[model samples]
Target: MCNDEDTIKELTVGRRVGFYKVRGQIGCGNFSKVNLAVHALTKDKVAIKIMDKMRLDLQTQWMLSREIFNMESLYHPNLLQLYEVLETPSRLYLVLEFAGGGDLHTRISSGGKLSDQESKIVFAQILSAVKYMHENNIIHRDMKAENVLYTTNSCIKVADFGFSKRVNNRNQALDTFCDVWAMGVLLFFIVTGTFPFHADTVAKLRQSVLEGAYVLPTWVSAPCQRLIRGNLRSDAHWTRCWVASGSHTTASPTLTPATPPSPPICVAWQME
Candidate 1:
């Protein structure tokens, strides 16, 4: 049934979005909604991000196209894979890999602090993905726990590129530092089950982040603390601040053979 607003109370469960059949709504955001869907021919489960074109400005539409193009061009095991795009007169649909394990935030919230091995695994995967992106000159401006998804194989996939941008050079100062800062925050959460900077209000949280005001728990191990603090340092040239000479060979012996070497590149300094 349609509501007074003339919108359906819920999108038809079996409605087709491109070659996928929508099973149900899985998530929603300010300008879009995501549906759990399955391939009509292959029966493969996927997540489809549906955005109503009528509600979007031309610039927003351009951004969406850019995101799709970026995702389509990039391929890494640790990055969420985008399969197809279906653009209609009224809407745009993006077929993406369905992460059955949800996001890292949900896992951290429900399972408590991650074991050291788990932390190492996740950190390794994300760093590998980010390093690849950097090598390709793509900066994932948005990197947070909510954007890191876990797969059925216990591997993490870096998701979301709405804020991503391509640059001519990664050196000479770049906004990718924000990504590094967020990675540091994710590392802190994995070890401590909480953010390094927290406040009741968004304004206060922004202030805390800008001022680099945060406390590290006494219980965290020295190596872990060093890793976190090294990335979360206060440096003007964040891209050049990674300790150990921006090496990725720091993987602990506990990490599995399948895991990528520890983040060898520079993580970055605090954000403004």
Candidate 2:
């Protein structure tokens, strides 16, 4: 648990942290909170993830280090950009690109289900990003709607690398199949605005997912239903082929690569 002083420091707003002036809290998780901040010099908006050092156990520390290393090594338009890393005696901060349009979960929850074209547009970006990660031997173990962010222009930005892993070889990374499964789940959520699997308990949920049982509404298009079914199949080999073929036929028009943004100035500061 964080002490009184540490808690105070975290809750305080408008204070400067490194090169950015912190603002109101935007989001929070179990051990860390994200704040919206602006760079003092360039005035660019950024999300600063503040983590309490005391709250991070050894396992969490290793995961944090892996997340940072994986993020720093990646350069993709659909992936979140990590601009800087800062460390202090009591806290650690990660300066990241800010996505003003909120996350996929919130969008779906607020606006109801997306139309066929809209779902294709969003899923295409996610497919491109996941394809890139697999090609680079990185597996995003967690690929839910919540981890998918949108920019002001509605472009997809996959974030949260805490569960990501870099394998030695792309072929050896069977976990990529799990990512394929997640893509199926995400696609279902995008079009239907609901999870494919539903259960009141964790065990039942696991069983539901494992059984791969879900019904598509009659309003869903035939091609879209086929794509979702292919992705959620038990055979990993067939699922991969289906994704490759279906992505082209379904979302080809909007599957064009996003232009990479200019690199940000990287800097680090230690607090006394």
Candidate 3:
């Protein structure tokens, strides 16, 4: 149970909430704030996402509901785990798995492009998570580097389901393809150290994305280039080309904190 009178300030460091004690702040978004907390009895570290229900619109509420629904039903090692949920008159609380390595976007921003093998390892985990979601009838509409997080084990965990949706029929294929396009964008960043589309404004960015005009750097491996081409252009070719190419033959293995070798083996249909 949660207290309606417990203000946001009461959620700061040294404050107590239910069976958890707040340690410090984690981060904040438009409608929610995250805090580092510890379970009182077990002393287990966890991240608590606190969303102010008063600040959310109907659409945002719907998204949150979908996020909870999707998470409650899906379970994968590479996917961030939702531990518990709590509610009050004014807020919704979600206890989530803490990922110490932060997000892939931050890593890429600090350390240019990753090596081919490193990119492959990270990508394989991402594909595995996406494949699992699709198989479970969920489509992560917002798949990007920022949403891909790393845990203490150095394993990839796909986070954030606010933009995710559950699809039951073939009519939702295009929406799912958007994820493939986003994956292509992420892969381009990992392999070439840059986004495939560049624009000064949102309109221009949308235009660039629709055009799918990107220059593949020479250093990128041939197999990766093929994957990018199949994804960045012609949504129709994405599934077919990836499958026919026989590149999805790798399995995701646990990667050590050392230099990596060839990428993981995966299939195209499995990736989707």
What's the TM-score of each model vs. the native? 0.82, 0.85, 0.82
Model 3 residue 131 CA deviation (Å) reads: 0.5
Which portions of model 1 show Cα errors greater than 4 Å?
1-14, 200-204, 236-272
List the lowest-lDDT window of 10 residues for candidate 2.
Answer: 263-272
lDDT of 3 by residue, 1-272 (tens): 45545553354324766678877888899999999888989999889999888999999998899899999999987888899887776778899988777888888899888776677767877776787787777888899999988774346789999989898774555566677777778889887778888889999888877787678988776667776776676655555334223244332133233323212233222222
| lDDT values for all models | 0.74, 0.80, 0.74
Candidate 1 residue-wise lDDT, 171-208, digit = tens: 64366677677778989998999989989999999899
| Candidate 3 TM-score, true structure as reference | 0.82
Please write out the lDDT profile of model 2 over residues 1-272, one tens digit for every residue: 33466644644434988678999999999999999999889999999999999999999999999999999988887899999987766788899999988999999999998876667667777777788888778889999999999874457789999999999965677778888999989999999999999999999999988898789998887777777887888898876665444343442323443334322111111111
Looking at model 2, residue 7 earns an lDDT score of: 48
Flag the better candidate by TM-score, 2 or 3.
Answer: 2
Candidate 3 error regions (>4 Å): 1-14, 170-172, 240-272
Prediction 1 TM-score vs. true: 0.82
Q: Give the candidates in order of TM-score, highest first.
A: 2, 3, 1
Evaluate residue 89 in candidate 3 and report its C-alpha lDDT on the 0 to 100 scale. Answer: 69
